[model samples]
Structure formats: C-alpha cells, structure tokens
Target: MHLDVIIGVSKNNKSGACDVNDIEKLGSDPKVVELFKLKKDEVIFDDDSDIFITSGSTGKPKYAVHTHFSVINGVKGMFYYLEGMPNKENRRIILGLNTAHISGEGSGVLSPLVASMTSVFAPPVYNIKQIVQTIQNERCTDVLFLITYLYDMLNFKDIGEYDVTSLDICLTGGSNIPPKLAKDFEEKFACKILIAYASTEMMVPSISSPWDPLEARCSGVRILPNAEIQLVDDDGKCVPLGSNGEIWCRCCSNFQRYMGNDEQTKAAKSPHGWFKTGDLGVFNAAGVLSIVGRKKDMIDRGGIKIFPADIENVLSQHPSIEQVQVIGVPDERLSEEICICLRTKKNAIIEKDQIVSHLTGKVRLEESVPGYVLIFDSFPKSITGKIDRMSLTKQAIDRIQSKVQ
Candidate 1:
C-alpha cells in the first residue's frame, strides 16, 4: 500500500526497497498496509506472536503460525542438520519467485539474512536457458528448486550445457516429483537433487540432503529439532516406527490461526498441540520418514494401499517421459486401480507397456505402478504451479463413469 508523494529526497544509498506506500499504488488498500505495520511491530515484540508462512497458493490460504522462538527453533534444526551433513559450509546462491509464499519467503528470501548470504534476486521464468545464463553470469553456486520449474529446466538440454559444473546441489519440494526427473537431474548435472517436503504450515520440515543415504532420501525424512512428528492410525493410536500412518507435526513454528477462518483453524489443529498434515507416511529402516502419499489420495486397490507417488517416481525416469502424475481410478475388480496422467517430450502416442517396461528395471511391477497410462496436453495447475491432481482425477473419473453408464 504505497503512497506516491515523496516531497523531500535525502538518501544514503538508493536502495530498491518497496515499502507499504509503494504497494498502495498497486491496489492494496492503505488500511491493509497500516494494519500490517501495526501487526508486524506487535508480533516482532510480543512473546506470543505467531510466525506464519502463507501457502504458495490458496483454496483458502492458511497463515501458518509460528512464534519467534519457533522460527529460531526450526532454523536451528535446519542448520544443525546441515552442519552434520558433509561439506555443509558452502555459501549458497538463491533464486526464488517473490510471492510471499512460505517457500519463496522463508527459504528463498529470508534465509540469506537469517541463515547465510543467499543469492537474492528475481529468478528466470522457468526458462532453462535464461536460468543457466543467470547462474553462469552470476556464479551463484546453488539453488532451491520448485518441481515444476526443475522439470522444465531438465527438458532444455542434456545437462552438459552452461557451466553446470559449478552447481553443487538443487533442493526441490512442495509436492512429489517424478523419480525419473530426479534421476535425470542427478545424471545430467552430476549433482544430487534433494527432495524437500513442507507446507504453508511448516516451512522446512523434511529435507533429504545430498549427504544422506539413498534410502533415507525416498522417505519424508526425520522431523527437524523442536518439531514433533508422529504417525497415527485412523483410530488415533500411535503406530510403530515402520508403519504407514497419517502424519502429524507439532512444534513452536505452528501457525497461530487461519487469517479469517476459525473452523479450519480448529480442524487443522488439535487440542493437544499437533496439526494433522493430511499426508500419509512411514519411517524406513534407518528412521527416515517416507511420505507414502496424501491420505485422501491413497488408491484402494482391492484393499491394498496404492500410493501414486511411488509409481510416478518410477515412470518419470523413462527416456521418453517428461513429467507424470499417478492417480487412483475406480474399477470393479480392485475397487480402485491406478491411472497415470503424463505429459511427455518423447512421443505423441504413448504406450503403457513402455512405461511399465521402463519402470520394471527400477521396481517390481506389482508393488506400485499403474495398469494404465493416460496422456494429456497439460495439467490444470495450482497457484504455486504444481499440478492440480485432484481436479484431474475428478475429470478422469467422470469420463470413465460416463462410458460405463
């Protein structure tokens, strides 16, 4: 909410900072600006003020509340884990979109000031060539990647072009990435791509850094310090370490309440301090947590649980594939079977066998991959640009049901 009337001009160094007055000219109300200032000041000082990260987009944006103490706690955990990992002291160069979404705000923007001297600048618009050019020109050595953008970058070249030799790591998150994309990125760039899993509610909860063993990487990862992670069965009882259960996290960094919605705040939070993440997962042998998939999205195949991410990861590695999402479809034999909706750069006519054949080398066919492959022009994406799989699945179901009738 920026106002455009600076009568006097006396400045030390002309910084390109945008204050509230500047925002006012762009459509935000002046009152919103004033309220933000007041709230920020009060929260910055108040011991109980909640620190929140807005979801990258909204079906109703939940302001994840975290206190100053919580932010410090979460940050400490991140740094501690980084310290324990191999060669953790490298200075990082950051590229992020400025949307005030937690990933962009907390990881990309704030990390430089709070964590280290981050490479803070506007990023290329998911254009690989432009991104590579910037990286080469700036000599910024690392990146925190969004899956949608990372997939785009991988399609640009075979991985040898543009001083990629300097890149040490790329951290990707927000949602599941096709495993093939992960493998190709590693092979092409010769750097490990760590999978990151977090939400608006928790900024940086689960990270699989390059230093971890491969098995640890597939799981959601252990809860960071000061963060409480547990898996409970549908009955609300705590499950064993290796069991697949609904994931929950409780910590100081939790959001205060949804901005204007009280009911959602209540449902998302428990009286005992935990918040249901809505994700389902399990801890692997070494205590590393693996996100099986969304609890609501789990496909029941004749009673066997089918997590599409497991299969999507497998299919994504095919040479003909670009990106893919797996969803459950209703079937008489199994109640629910698997259907893969994919977008590819390899071929116009997709063959399900090719996907099955490609994935058989990586995993057993019976364990996870779908029986069918459905190709589409593109996906309906969320505000964060992640695929809106829920919508896609709904449409797929409608089309199939119509045929059945």
Candidate 2:
C-alpha cells in the first residue's frame, strides 16, 4: 500500500497531520516502518491544494480545492468574527455536521483550531438524541448545527431530558434560520444562537455576533473582516440596497475552482475573482446582509415568479409544522406548481385544508399558496444536512403520479 499522507490520532481521539519525514525517528520497529513507508513523490503544498467536496444539493457535487493560503485566511476570517464571542478559550465545541463536509471541517475543526478552543466529535449517526447526549457528556460550550439538525433537536420530545445548559453559544447556517425555531431553541437551551453566512466555495463571509439582538441574529448578519460581498442582479450588475440580488463574494478563503469541471468553474467564478454564490440576498438600510433564497430555486408559475423562502417562512410559523420545505413541481396548465413538503410535530395531526387555511390569510399572493401538501415522517437531507429540495420535488411528483393511477 502506498501512503501519500499520514494523520496522527492522539489517545484522546483528536487527529493532526504527522510532519515527520523519517518514520524511524519515533523508535518504531525499523522493519515495520520500512514496510509501511513507500518512497513517493514529494508533493509541495501550495495555495491550490484540493480540500473540500461540496454537498451538491443543487446539482452534481463538485470538489472545492483550497490551498494552505485559503485555509489560513479562512481561519483568520473566523477568528475576526468570533473575536468577542464569550469565553473563547474555554469553549469545548461539539460538531453536529459531518466532518468531511466543509461546514463540519471549517466550524468543527478549523475555526476552533484558530480560536484555541476544543473540538468534540459527535457520534457518526446524525441523531438528535446522540447529539444531545454528547453535549451533556462533553459539557460543550459551543456547537454548530445545520438548520435540519437543529430543527430535529428542538422538536425532539426527550431533548429536555438532557442538560444542554452548558452551551454558551450555538451557530447555524446553510439556510435561513426560521425565526420561531431560533427563539424556541434559545429559550429552551438558554444559549445565544449565532447565525453565520458562508459556503464551501467561499468560506465564512459574515456571522451574527453573540451580542446581536434577536431580530438581527435571525434576519441580518454582520460582515466579517477580509471578506467582500456584493448583491448583483441577473445581468451581473450590482443591485441597489434593499433589493434582492445574487450574492457575489470575494474572500481570501474562496476555493480555487471546481475540480474536473471547467464549465462549472467558469460559470460560478468570474475572472476578477468574485465567486457567484447562487444564493439570493439583500442588504437593509443598516448595511446588514440577509439571505432570502437561492436564485436557482425560484419557481416560475406561468409568468408569475415566487421565492420559496417567502412561502417556507409563512409555513414554518404553523404550530404543528416542525419543519417545512416548499418546492416547485411540474404542472400541465401552468409552467410549475407550488408543493409544500413538511414534517409535523411528534404525533401532530394536520389536514390539507388546515395547512391551506393556515397560509390563506398570511400569504399575500394566491399563487404563492401551495397547490399540494405532502406530509412525511421526515424530509430528505443532503450530505451536508440541508433539506434536499430537488429530491423532495422528485419524490412529490412520483407520489402524485402514483395517486393518479
């Protein structure tokens, strides 16, 4: 077997790279060391080293290559945003995200490594009970969760049985954090929930401070240092403040390019170094940026357009709805129809009329109201723990077809 890289795992299960050139220096058996070590090409570590694979929820997964330069810069960016966070050195953060994923590596490992904090690896399974149990066992002071993971934890019936009070602050991103979920989680866990805006292609750009007001924490995020963000329209021109536009970001931590796909790389990145983040965002009068939805996820019903975030936000407020995802399904008359896929609270009962009635008064546009509602025990999740809208749409369409037969 040939080994290009070696990682040293500590007795405590923490991992770090082994930088030793000669394996025999550690007094290991010479025969065994020679058998394990094969003479390989001396690879140089530079700014274009491959590092991450994107979740690929929108389409095919892409390899996000980062260099030593980008990694260090990302750590610096996280450090800048987390500077004033409470008890930085004392933080024992738990990782709820998958370690191989960018959010997991960045938040669970890189961020803590920069901040001089401890990173606790959660169990392999992404179960809420296991996560809460790890938090209780480790007395974790901080943790990062995807919206789906956080929602599951908050809705867990037995979550109150665990002691999560040791948590000082929690971070979440990848999607708009529902306001109700944020409030309920904070109230129940008694910890400040900090929201961050970032992507695998471009590392941390902005994050809400621990001291931010609830509204600011939920809807707006403070821009971090060493990162530049611009909201641009379809023509790639900067949009006026308060107008929705595609989020374009330039940062030191930005990935070099998508491996093996020059077309995708060119489409997502500009020659000027700005990475088009596909996400739609807006800047308020206060210059605080808030993510609204994904530009590619927009639903066009005939000629009318709808952003799923607007509909999801309204449905998320329903008392019985634990988690909701709005997607566009095919329609013969119209170009597309709105479909609401959701998971209800434990043992909660909901009817189609009940869901429609819940949104009728709140949703302004009649077209925005869901044409179909599909309830499931759980929604499909991407590798990064995000709700997979594409898969959900396919599943909804298949179920509807089956029903027609």
Candidate 3:
C-alpha cells in the first residue's frame, strides 16, 4: 500500500488496510514489501523481553527492535513527573493528531493511558475550525498536540467565545514550534504549555507539564530519570555545554536493535549502546535541552520527514520557475510545513498560487512541498557565499507563520 499506511498497518492492521493494488504497488519493490523483519542478534520480545522497531530519522529509516520493558520505561519516564498536575480526567479534550504520528499510538496513546487519562483521536486535516469545534463540543481539557495544531487552535478568531477554559495543558514538539506561535498560545490560553521532546527512540523527553516561560518553551526537553542524553561531535566525544552537537541517548526505554539492517544498526547505535537521535540540541544552564535543528537534511511536515532537496530539484524545472530553495516550517498538522523560497526569473512571472497549483499537479512535491513559498530579492549567503539554507529555512518558516496570525 502507501508508505504511510505501513505505520497504520503495523499498529492496527485490521480492515485489510492495504488492498490488492496496494499490494501490487508494494510487491514491485523488495524494499517496499519487506519493511520489518527480525534480526539475527535479537529475537522478538516475549514473556522475557520487549521488542519494537526504531523510528528511522538519521540517514535512512530503520526498524529498531525493542521490548515491553522499554515501552514502559518510556511512559513512566514521561508521566512520572506529572503526579502534581491536577488530574483533569473530569473532562478533557485531546486533539489527537500527535498519536497518528510515530508517537501517536505509543506516547500519545499508551503513556496517557498509563496515566489513566482519556483522549480524543483527531485526524491530520488542517481545519482549524473543525479542531476548535471539537474542543468546544468535547470540552477537552488537555491537548497532546504538536505546535502546528496548537498554534492554529489558539488563533481561531472565536476561540474566546468557545468556553475553552476547560483546556489547561498544551503540549508540543513532535517537530519544531514557532516561538511566535508559542507566545501567542501562552497569552491566549493563560495556561502554561510544556513541550515534550523525544523520538522513536522514546517519546517522553520532557516531563509532561503545562507551559514553561518563553525561554523554556524550546522542545527536545531535558533528560528524564530513566534516560541519559549526550550531545556529541563527529568524533563521538561529548561536546561542551551550549555547543551544537548530535544528540545521543542511552536509555532503558530505547529500542534494542534495528529490525533487519545490520548497517543501520551499527550506524544508529554506539559501541556503548547509545542510540543516536540525529537531532541537534544544546543544554541550558539548568540542564534542560533545547533542540536547535536536525543533523539530517530533512524537513518535518507535522511529524513526517520530507527531503526538500528531492522536491526542489523537481520544482525548479517548472516552465514558470527559475531557482528554488525548499525548507520546512512549523505546521499545525505536520510539525513542520514545507516552504519553498525562490526567484521567478522566467519570461512570465509565476503567481505564488499558480506555483502551488503547478506543483500540486505536475511535481513529486504534491504532498511534500511546503504549504506555500517565500519569494525574495535575494537570499542570505554564508561567508563562503553559499546560500545559508538553515537561515533561509528559518526565515521562510517565520515569514509564513507570521502571516498565519
């Protein structure tokens, strides 16, 4: 079937989620049909151990095999600190797109269940109206959602009219959250929002709580008791505090092995058993972790990984186009939104909406392109005159987000 369905299949494979045509499509590629397989070094977790697949975020997607023990550890480590939060089980609304992502079933579902909390499962649609309506209808209290959804929900023009005071805790960070959006949510809700940062390696990076101050709003939160994270440079040595470094975690909650790929296993895990998260983060003076960016050149649409270089090359050839740079920004649905910044140097200038229309119909980027584009007179360059992609990407995301308000 579709690549995204495999996750649904792996979780709730009922209803013949993949039809025959889906099978035919998958059967064409050996890599496609065969995604998860057992490894020689590891057996499935049974009465003795827990086993699961890894969230492949680094170089390639790999399946890490882990056990129930790790799952419990993931949940406990995240919720253990929330004993103090007023148990809002009285009546809470959970806008649940976060669960549909990699962490959807696990962190968003299981961990909350462990806490004896009830939640509502929402779809991946970007309908802010529908989301707000759901909150009003359900009178949901807690929102286990990413930055995109939470940001949009807060901006809903009639939000104050909805009696949404029942909502208390706002969570984010399956991907990036715009600081501006974070600030708006803080003011609108008057409720503290805490960001939870973790990966397929594990879901509870920060102890689940209400909002933190602006400076503490950054995600990929500090290490929990059951986990240990280190920011390391290329040589595998720990980097000093405040320096950019690849985040590595050796945790009791982590997966045990890459399902079938030996090379993936070796590349993902350290000699000492730490799993490299591929995300880059810096520690605060108080030991909280703030994720600055990712090591892999990939974009997160909501929580889905999109490679911009793959899409931009395809978009550049449009008869209306000239040059382009694609990057992701905070999206309410996918943690990140794919945005293209470019110059239309063609004989006929292409309208922004036209470019979106063309790509939606003509290019491989129909689903991957950012919701829109950012055209500029020029792009900032590095000291070496290289286009500063990271800076450009942040700018593009910021520009788009500013318009959302």
Candidate 4:
C-alpha cells in the first residue's frame, strides 16, 4: 500500500530483489530522497502492472498506469478492427515511435510482445533514410507514425527511391493528419492510411479502419467496440449529434489518474468517470469521430473564436508549404491575432503576400486569415516530436515587441 512497498516489488526494478525495509531506507537517504519525493503521488504501480510515460506535449510529463487486462483489451481491440485487412499474415511491423510515449509503448512494445510479432525499431534519432531502408530490407507490412514523422516521410526528397511496396497498413496518431497528406500517401504508396485517435489516458479508443469508406477513412475514426465517447459543451451538457464539442472518453483501457497530480486528475475526470480529453471533436451522422482542435488551443480573435487547426489545414495545402503551425499572438485591439509560423519545402520560395493571397482565395472568413505570417527554417518540437506551440508563441511575442520598440 505504501510507496516503498510498491517500489520494492515492482517487476521493472532491475536493481536485484529488495524488501519494503530496504526500499524505505533508500527512500529515506538524503541523497536520493529528494528525487523520490519530488512528486507527492509518484508511487510505483503493482509488480505486474504496465507503465507508460506520457510525451508531455502540453506540459510536464507523467506516468500512465495500466494493468495487464487493460493492455490486453487495447491490443485485442486493435486486432479485432484490423482482422480483415490485407497482409494480416505479414506480422513485420515498423515502430518508428519513441517507446517512452504511449503510441510507441502500445504498438512497439506491448502489442507486438503479446501477439509475438516482429517489430523493427528505428534508430534513436530516427533518420528518414535509415527508416526507409529498414522498411525495404525488413519488408515491413505495418507501420505506425506520429503525425510529425508522417509529414517528414511524405516530404522526404528521396522517398520514391526506396522500395516501400511491402507496406500494407499505415497508421498515424499523436496529432491530426492533413486530409491531403493522407490521401497523397495512400495514392503514392498504394496502401491504406488509418488516422487513429487515442490518448495516453485512454489507449487506442478509436481508429479509422480499412473497412471504412474512402472519404471517411481519410477524415475521421470509427470508435472501437467497448469504448464510449461523449461530446459535451462548456457547461458539460452533451452536444447534439454532428456538432462540435469537447471529447470525453471512457473505456476499459483508460488510465487511473495523472500519476502525481491530484488536482489535474480531479479536473480531467467527471463524476461518471468520463475523462475530459480537452480536444474538441464532432461525430458524423454515421457516428464516426473527427477531431477539430484542442479547447486550450483555440484563439479568441476579438469576440470570435478561431480554431488554429482550420487555418493550419488550409495553409498545409499550399504547394510551397512543408509544415505549418497556427498560434495566437496578443493584440491590443482584437485581444488575440492569428499568427502562422510555417516551414517551406527545400528550394521553395514563399512570400508573405503570396500566403495572404492564398488564404484570401481559400479561407472564407476574413477574420480567419492570419494577421501575421512568419517563415521558419524549422519549428520547435517537444520531447514527443510535436510542434511546440508554447515556444513559438513566446518567440512571436518577442518579435512583435521588438518591432514596436
């Protein structure tokens, strides 16, 4: 029940066997106690429990706790949905994700371990050329990519040079995939791209299956069996079907809590146990779920609310654009003005005027247009390889302040 007892009996403890007394002594030692006590609730899971560290894309990283039953349920759900897809016999899977995160833990470690499948891990730094070579050499049949990695691979200059004909199922998660990028990858690679929707809190709740229609496959995900999804407004009232609202999920695989943050755990969970995902989503008439954007990521442009994903999706279609992140910058008049930070393709030249004109033709709302466009060689990335909007917002603020001075 206590922390020391939990640590002493943890299966992951590789420091030889020890009892509760020894662990307590170690915890009491001045040199190591501070580290152990940094988080009040940082207790180890049971000996047989499966633990995964979150990517900390939003803030500080935390541990997500799962039991054997939960992990098995998640893996079973994946197999159940992927059962009828082609290349089911081909178990060679390429896991190009960071194992520390749930995306990697579930697909790379747990799923393969339970199913006895071969998982080809990319190098620590994940060189695109090396990954491409591995797929060709291993003849990997299934590959899971984080959105950033997917974009990088799709934009890789020598992508056509590699023999990637072996790929059957391509899955992407951690962030939304541009519809154009998904469609392009499928057309070029001759494989189905499944855009999965899941969180560290609830592992693999829904994923776009190959059974879905082509347009639905590219747009949203079908909720897996045994998982429940509810979309609720700011007042916690359930939204009508086909309307946008915050996504709340509850399922067998949902994590118990934020490892050491009681306040966060309380705030994220409702009385009925539905964990508030903080991301906005909408369900179609057919009940498939499509993510809109994060509630916290929405920008207040004067009185109107703007979702950055909308602008980012539009700009991502520009021929010269390689990657784009839309953020909000402080504005005296409008409260928050839209600022887009973009990375252009190699040897591509794009001007602010060109982007403005492009948006003018594509974006219907005048207010949705980005107030400022800044081109960057590369965007700041979090530990999980997501674009660090917080960092970019700070840089944008600094740039704006300097100009006023």
TM-scores of the models, in the order given: 0.79, 0.88, 0.61, 0.85
Question: Ranking under lDDT, best-scoring first?
Answer: 2, 4, 1, 3
Q: What TM value does model 2 have?
A: 0.88
**C-alpha lDDT (0 to 100) for residue 280 of candidate 3:** 76
Model 4 stretches astray by more than 4 angstroms: 1-48, 113-116
Write the residue-wise lDDT of candidate 4 on 1-405 in tens digits: 134423344345556546656766786689787765685465443223666777666777777777766676777667665555555556788988887677787767777665666788877677888988899999998888877877777778898888999888888887777777777788888878887888878888998867776678767888989699999999999999988999999887777776667888889889888989999999989898989888888899888888887777778888999888888898999998988888898899988778787777566575446788787888787787877777878888888788789
Best by TM-score: 2
All candidates' lDDT scores? Answer: 0.67, 0.82, 0.63, 0.79
Indicate which candidate wins on lDDT. 2
In terms of lDDT, the poorest run of 10 residues in model 4 is: 1-10
Off by over 4 Å in 1: 1-69, 81-90, 97-99, 124-126, 157-161, 330-335, 353-372, 398-405
lDDT of 2: 0.82
Better of 2 and 4 by lDDT: 2
After superposition on all CA atoms, what RMSD does each candidate show versus the true structure?
6.3, 4.9, 14.2, 7.4
Give one digit per residue, the lDDT tens place, for model 1 in 1-405.
244543222233255545544455655777777877787755652264443545433344455655666556555555554445444345555564433566665566555445545554645344557677776776656677678877777777644557767776777777876655666677777666777777777656767756665445644566666677888998778998788999888876666666666888898888997888888888877667788888878888888877777777777666666678888888889998788888877655668777766777566556445756677778777666677776788777876677669
- Pairs that collide in candidate 4 are none
Per residue, candidate 3 scores C-alpha lDDT tens digits across 250-365 of: 88777766555687778878899888887777886878787666676567665555655446645656655545667666666667666778766535576766766656754455
Ranking by TM-score: 2, 4, 1, 3
Each prediction's number of clashing residue pairs: 21, 0, 26, 0
